[model samples]
Target: MTDPYERLRAEAEAGRVEEVVVAVPDLQGRLMGSRLSVPYFLEEAARGGFGACVYLLATDVEMDTGPGYAIDAWDSGFGDFVLRPDPATLRTVLPWDEGTALVLADAVWPAGPGGGHGPGHGPEHGPEPVAVAPRHVLRTQLDRLAARGLTAYAGTELEFLLFTASYREAWERRYTGLRPAARYNTDYSLQGLEEVEPVARRIRRAMTRAGLRMETARGECHPGQYEIVFRYDEAMATCDNHVLFKDGAKRIAAAEGASLTFMPKFDEGEGNSCHVHLSLRGTDGTPVLADPSAGDGMSELMRHFIAGQLACLPDLALLMAPNVNSYKRLQPGAFAPTGIAWGRDNRTCPIRVVGSGPSLRIEHRVPGGDANPYLAVAAAVAAGLYGIDNRLPLPPEHTANALADPAVPRLPATLTEALHRWEGSGIAAELFGKETVAHYARAARAELSAFERAVTDWERVRGFERL
Candidate 1:
C-alpha cells in the first residue's frame, strides 16, 4: 500500500494520469462531486480541499429537500461545504475516462462567513469538520475502537441485478420491461455468468487495480443478479473500498451499455443484499472472537458483541435498510433474516457465527443490498462496542429455523416501524451522535412519508377497476 498521493504524483509526473476526481458520499451513498484536471487537483484540491454545495449532505436521493433535517435548507439558503481530500483514499479508476484517479473527501463547513473554513486549511485556525457527515460518522466509530486498543475489520459483499437496457434506455423506459443479463437462476453457474462475464470481469479488474482484495465474483440465485466478494480489511479501509467497488461497478455497467440497481427488490423477483462479515482483533493481532476452550468456539467477548448487535438491530435497521422497498426483501422465504437470532453458519438467522479458529467472525445478514456501507459499518461497530461496554449477555443460540421460532425477537417489518424503533433508540443516538441520528432519522421518515403519499400501481390494480 503506497501513499495514494505519492502514487498519484508519480503517475501524473510520468504523464500517465490526466484527470483526478474529488468525491464525497452523499446521504444516499452516491458519490457526488466533480472532476479536476490533474494539475489543479494536485496544486489546490489535493492539499487545501475544495468547496461543494452544502445541500449534498442535506438532500434526498432525488436531491430534493426533506423537512425536519437540522442542516441547511431554503430558509438558511444553501451554503458551501468544503471537501477535505483524504490522501489515503486516492486510487485509479480504470475503464473510466482514460488516465483517471479518484479520491474521497471529508466535508467541512465554515466556522463563519469568509473567516476561513475546511479542516487543515486557512490561518492557523479554520473551518470545522461536520461531525455528523457520513464519512465522519464512520471515522468516529473506528477511532473509538482504536482508542480501546482494538481493531475493527469487516467486508461488504454487494449483490446487484444487471439489466440489458443501457442506462439511457432504462431511463427512457422508466426502468420497465427491461430484461435480466441472464434468463435463468445462475447461482454459481459459470455458464450462466458467461452472459455477464464481460461486465463482471471489467468491474472486478477495476476494483483490483483500485486495491480491493477481491475474493469472488459470481451469479447468485436470481436472474440478472450477481455478487462480488472482498477480503476483509480494517473498517475504514473496507468501507472505502466498498464505495469504490460500488461506484466502479455502476460506471462499468453504464459504459457497457447496460444498467443495474442495488435496490433490495426489483419488482416481482428475488432481492439483492449487502451482507457484512465482521470481527475484532487485539493490538497484537489476535483474533479476539476465538476461544479454543469455548464450546461454540466463541469467547465471552464475542458473545457480548453478538448480544449487543441483537439489542441494537432494530435501532439501526433504518441505517441498514433505508428505502421503502428495502422492507420488501426482509420477509420470510426470501432467505433474508426476519428474526434476531444467531446460528452456527445458519443462513436463516440474522447473525451467523462462522469459523471456529482464527477466522472466527459474525456475519450480520440484516442489511439489504441498498444499505450505506459507511453507515452500516458504523451502526454494527457502535452496537458491538456498546455491547462490550455494557457486558450484554448473548441470547440462546437459535438452533432451529429462526423464521419459525416463536420466542425469538422479530425485527421491524416495515420502514415505518423501523423508523419508530430508530427514533426511540438511545444507543443509536449515543453511537452515531445525537445530531447524526436526528438528521438521518428525519431523512428516513421523509422518505417514508413521500412513499405513503404516493399512489402505487398495487392500489390502482386493487381499487381502480371494480370500486
Candidate 2:
C-alpha cells in the first residue's frame, strides 16, 4: 500500500532494481518500450521518458505507419514526443530478471506553445492528445466520479490461449501443427486443467507475488484456453493490475517454453475475451445496486445506470471492441454477445445482473482481450452517468437470444460502422468531446482502409484457383 513511485525510487537506490522499462502502446495495442538503467531512470527518464512521434498510437498492427493521420508523416519529419510517467502505475516487476521495475506513462502532446511540445514542432491542429490514449480519458472520467463523492471498483476476466511455442514459430509453421495447452475442451474440467497444471499454477502465483489480487484461474471452453479472474478494487488500481496480470502471464508462459496469446479468437472453435465486472459505492461505502424486495433486487440508482448503459451502447462499441478483428468475435452463436441486453447471471447476454445482497452489479461481456481498459471504463461510466441524470427506462429482461431477435437492440457489426455511430453520438460528445471523436475516427478509418487493401490467405487459396 506504499506509494509506488517512492518504492521504485527506493528500490533503485538500494541497488535492487536493474532495468526500468517504460512502455506506451502503439496503434496495434502492442506495448512498445525503451529500457533505461535504474540510475538514469530515477534521475531523468522517470519524470518524462523520450518517445517517437504520433505514429506510435496512429499506426496499425503491421506498423505500416500511415493512413488517416493528419499529425505525422514522412514530410513531417516524424518528430519525438515525451512519455510522462504516471507515478501511480510504477510497480515492481516481480517476474522479470534480477529485480526490475516497470512503469507506464501518459503520452503527452509534447509539442505546441508555452513549451510542452517537442523541438522543431510545426503547427498542429492544436496541442491535443491522441485518441488512442484510453488511460488519459479514464482519468478524466474518474475525476468526475471522485467529484460526485463516489468510488468505482472493477475486475476483468483475462481469457487467452496457451500455445506450445512463440508466435513467430507458430506463424512459420502456418499455424498448422501448433497445439493448445490442453487436449480437450476444458470448461471447468479439473482433469483437463491438470494437463496444463504447470503453466496455470505458475501464472497465478507469479501474478499474485507481483502484487496482483489474483482470485482464481480456471479452464475455459476451447482446447488450450484459460481464464483468470482477479479480486476487484478501486478502478484505477484494477486497470493497473490488469496490465500487470497480462505481462506476468506471458512471461511465465514463455519461461515454460510456451507462449500465451490474448487474441480474441485464435481458432474457429474457441475465442478469448476480457469480461469486465464493475460496481459503484458511495462516499459512505454503501452499494448503489442493492435494494432487496425491488425488481431484480436492484435499486432505482442501479436501474438508471443500466438504462444509461443500454441507451449509449452504440457509442461505446468502439472502445469495447476497438480492433478491426474484434468484430469477428461479436457474431451470434459464438458464445459472444452482439446485442444490448441484460439478464440474471446469463453469460450469453451482453450485460449480466449479479449479486443479491449488498454486492449487486452488472458485468459487461462485450470487450475482448484487445480492448483498452481505460477507454472501456470511461465509456461505461459516462453512459451510466447519463442514465442517472436523465432517468432512462430500463428495458425488460432478456430471456431468449438477443442477437436473434431483431426487436432487441443490437450493437454495430464492424469497426467502421461503430466509428460512424460514435462520431454522431451524444454520449461521445459529452464524455470524450467532439474533437476526440473526430480524431479517433481518422485513426479507425485508416485502419479499416488498410485492412481492405490487404488480400488474405483465405482469398488467395479459395479464389485463386477457381475464380
Point to the candidate with the largest lDDT.
1
Worst 10 residues of 1 by lDDT: 113-122
Cα TM-score of candidate 1: 0.95
Point out the worst 10-residue segment of candidate 2 by lDDT.
113-122
- Candidate 1 residue pairs in backbone clash: 117-127, 118-127
Query: Tens-digit lDDT track for model 2 on 1-467?
Result: 75446777777778888778787755344566688887788778775565656567666566766544544455456666567777777766676455777777777776555433333444563434544465667777777877887778888888998878676787688776788888888898888765477888888877777778777888988888898898998888787777767767787787788888897866677678988888999978888778887856888888988998888888878878877878888887788998888888888788888877777888988989887777777778888888888899888888887768788778898998898899788778887877567667777777688889888777888999999
**RMSD of candidate 2 to true structure, Å:** 3.4
Tens-place lDDT per residue, model 1, 188-207, is 88786666888888888877
Instruction: Note the Cα lDDT for every prediction shown.
Output: 0.84, 0.77
Residue pairs of candidate 2 with colliding backbone atoms: 110-116, 110-117, 110-118, 111-117
Off by over 4 Å in 2: 1-6, 25-29, 48-52, 70-76, 111-132, 293-295
Off by over 4 Å in 1: 1-4, 111-126
